[model samples]
Target chain A: MTALPPKLQDYLDDFSFITTREERADFLIDIADSFQPVPARVASKPYDEAHRVIGCESEAFVWAVERADGRLDYYFDVLNPQGLSAMAMSAILDEACSGAPLEQVANISGDVVFAFFGRDISMGKGRGLTELINAVVYHARQRL
Target chain B: MSDIKSRGYANADKLVSTDWVAAHLNDTGVRIIESNEDPLLYPSGHLPGAVEVDWVKDLNDPLRRDYLDRAGFEALAGRIGISPETTVIFYGDKSNWWATYALWVFELFGHTNAKIMDGGRLKWAEEGRELTREKPDIGPTSYTAPERDDSQVRAFRDGVLAHIEAGGQLVDVRSPGEFSGETLHMPGYPQEGAVRGGHIPGASSVPWSRAANEDGTFKNAAELRAIYLDEIGLNPEEPTIAYCRIGERSSHTWFVLTNLLGFGDVRNYDGSWTEWGNSVGLPIEK
Candidate 1:
């Protein structure tokens, strides 16, 4: 099996130790606070529908720019200001998948959302965040 | 947009504005509660002295497909430091969808002193109000809650079937796609989808979000009347039932019809499409 993105695996490892919802929430909130949206150089308002993450209620958009070494740099924007979970997931994807091996990034499972956000997230939220992951993976698969 | 009272709601007192909440932040008789679809929202930042009540964890029964029981609710009430007489003001994300839902649950246990914060968290943030990450130090109150009385404000599957048989008014507060059977669930929510699509027969399609303005506040009474009473021709005197996937969105509509428009009787079918669409032998209309 192809190895997972090292940074992503580390995050999952860190989350695996989360024994309380409060701990998980605090960690995710911090991550969301660090989230930076896609720079204007990559995209802007009224983003192309092609980059929009399907099934995301957060109205998140994803862009995968190909680096010179054939790796990919992922950038994202979640339109809903209250969509902090989406923002955190986007930040994680940007940090973990960007410039990572295309094959590894493509192989990342959408279930990583459950790992990060936990099992208790509402069904709608879980699905939307999963779709955000799928959007990033779609770009990686397109490159491969 | 205007003062909540000036918006001409049938029950103007049911909703409080952000300014009211700010003024009442330190009022011992009132408790500010935030309930949201996103669990991260409350912990990140919230109204000062506000407590977070998660719909999934606080309001729901862990083992069953139902809400928390009387004992559970009492425990939650005590945990939140609210007495029967304490006025509860609920606010949250998703246009206060989950906030109204929490209020509905509290009502089931006879906590009638509940009100919603208009425009919810979005408006509060937009208005540049203070949001703090600090969790309030609340003293636990000994709350004695009555048994949950679902007959008044809640509808079961059998109750819904009989209601439809009796030609009771129903509102399908899902997206047009879901109401029309074009989609099994709201876009991006396939996991909550059912085996069958389409709304209950004789149900009017009014997406719950229509009740709200662009800023997430409820539309003035006249605009809301145009949609529910004028467009759909629903009589305010008639009994109504509103349902969406799992009944969270419908709670918003239930609040509108029951409180805003003064509909005499309205019940939210919390089982909703998840139960109806999946249940065997149930009739569905596209």
Candidate 2:
């Protein structure tokens, strides 16, 4: 385990502002509002090549950039019409892990990410969070 | 999709047009409920008079593995500004998937006055309808809870198994791959899926999408009849139970069978494959 990256720490800092499930959900919505969609070509690739995120409610793909400083940068593409929450989760990971140390990204736990939902999110939604975290961790570890 | 009225539903009033909603935007007795597959859609922009009702938050019981208790149902209705006499019109995205899901819950609480918007949000947008970011602040009212009637339209796992045991008609309203055990859940929605795949024994595979046109509105009665009554050979007089993963999609078929075609006995097995696939010793059809 490594020291928590500043950006990941910043996300945890902001987590205090989200007390209600709606607020936590709204935070993800805000992430969706700022998310960029994948290019047409990249989106059409096969799952293996697309780096598909298994276990999401939608087809999500990730690409990580390992910088000279040993930090990881992430870009995500989610292929589901109703996958706003997954996109938001990708955006959160993008901010938290991108440019952060690889060790920090690898160490970030799924539980802590969904703690935003305050133990009240649906069982299905809880799995969605875990899947997203698992995707991020899988990508980070592979890069590591 | 053609005019929904052409199909001649037993209660055609259950399907209202976007124009009807527009005309009744400020009408006190009509409470517009918007529940979407994507929870964030309401905040982005929605029908001016609609209040958001989440399937998970408002419909489910907090502690139990079931829907809200009798008092909780009444409180939820009142909290959402719905009274007994109010006509609840539902509409949302993903072809009104969550909208139908919410309407089914309303039916569980015996709110027969409920309705669905024809073509849902897609058709509304396709027809150049208006959307606003304004959220309505309607006053809460006293909504009396109807008696908990789980028998009429909802089917638990036990009832589903018994129906199978008794050689009853069961519709597995899931995708072909899921019915074949090739996929666990809808592509991307992995969380709602069970540990294993395949459907209950003796259940016919008729994906819920077959009941709807491409735009997400219900197909005409003739098309649905060809699928359900003719193709699947289900008798309208006998009871039919429909199930999907976690029960949302099946409600679409439940709405189609019970309301559209006038089937007197159709129940939505809400626990669905998630429950069935997890239970050990439960026979898996595939």
Candidate 3:
């Protein structure tokens, strides 16, 4: 299993310093801005059924690349920014799991996904976020 | 109640044609605003001289779940170069769902100069108008705002109860699944939904999408009048309320009633089903 991405850990550690929910959301949105949408090659294929993240409002997709050293780097893209549960969670997972070992990537927990934003979103959103984490972990386990 | 059809709800000039917006792209008094569910669309490409109004940051209070207060609205409007009387024309994706919602917020703040760009982004793109990648150089302006007036337009739970007791009308704009207590939320938004489902008692099922054609332009006044007045049996003199899961789509219907059909009394229950479905002892109908 892959350990969480060290850089994503760094982002969360640095994010933990932000005391305000509004400011944290602001910073996270900027991070979301930095995320690139899914590339056309993957998006144009028959992946809509296989790669579609369940329980998300927007179409959130994740496609990963396996390096020779057994590390997996994932790509996350979304159509709507207001699909905050999907977009934010996918972006976080992409950053957290990229270039990490497969099993470590599989080990990402619900707590990391839900609490990363520093605010308790609705139960429905929490469920969506969990679905996202599960998708990422499921793909990571499949890579092995 | 005021004659909303004649006056266009909050403003006389609330629905501007694409041609009107195109001709006035460089108009100094006009501030074209783009509000979308996808916040990233504007930075990519949008109508010239249009400003992006992020729903979370601009319309909503940064920390609270509520909307922006007077100072917050002022800051947002000022940053986008809108003055108290500036003609704010809103258009965006999703057939102007967020656009109308944004316009409603402007009205709540008593900005009587707000309007919706007819057909929104879809119509603009369909017409093959020139798109701009260059950001407009309009600098910020000192925009002051009055206290948000919820007197006539916004409907609270008690207010809705009173309206119902007083023989008011309610139009539920959610999908059939939601109206029938089948789905807890809109498709694909499972995370942001209510605890329960179903329609408010005495509310009629009138999905907001019915007001627009395939191209997103609103149906003519006659067609709109037929649905709300004849089919639904709503009279222009009686007060009416429209609601969706979170009030955005209902704002679309509200815009139709007050702006298009000019109903005398119209309100948008923004709290919508999320509130009604969660509250204790509130009656519902499936």
Which of 1 and 2 is the better model by lDDT? Answer: 1
TM-score of chain A of each: 0.98, 0.81, 0.83
Candidate 1 chain A, poorest ten consecutive residues by summed lDDT: A135-144
lDDT of 2 by residue, B1-286 (tens): 5566777677687898888899999898999988876666677678888899988778888778898888988888888898888899999876777889899988878888999998788778777778876778878888888778897889987888889999999999988989988888764455345887898999999988888778878887788888999998999999999998889999999999988888989999999998998988888978
Residue runs of model 2 more than 4 Å from their true location after superposition? A38-59, A65-72, A78-82, A123-130, B7-10, B125-128, B181-197, B277-283
Error of 2 at A127 (Å): 4.2
Supply the DockQ value of model 3: 0.18
Cα lDDT for residue B160, model 2? 84
List, for all models, the DockQ compared with the true complex: 0.91, 0.32, 0.18
Q: Could you give candidate 1's per-residue lDDT for residues A17-112 as a string of tens digits?
A: 999999999999999999999999999998999999888999999998888999989999999999999999999999999999999999999999
TM-score between candidate 3 and the true structure:
0.76
Maximum-lDDT candidate = 1
Q: What is the TM-score of chain B alone in each candidate?
A: 0.99, 0.96, 0.93
Candidate ranking under TM-score, highest first, comes to 1, 2, 3
Share of true Cα-Cα contacts across chains kept by each model: 0.93, 0.33, 0.20
lDDT of 3 by residue, B111-212 (tens): 977888878887797788976656788798897788888887999989988878777899999888889998887654563467778899899988889988
- lDDT per residue as tens, model 1, B1-286: 9999998899999999999999999999999999999999999999999999999999999999999999999999999999999999999998999999999999999999999999999999999999999999999999998899998999999999999999999999999999998998887787456889899999999999999998999999999999999999999999999999999999999999999999999999999999999999998999
Predicted structure with the largest TM-score when compared to the true one: 1
Question: Which whole-number lDDT from 0 to 100 does residue B30 have in model 3?
Answer: 92
Backbone clash count for every predicted candidate, in the order shown: 0, 4, 14
List ranges where model 3 is wrong by over 4 Å. A6-50, A61-100, A109-133, A141-144, B1-13, B61-66, B122-137, B143-145, B191-193, B213-215, B222-231
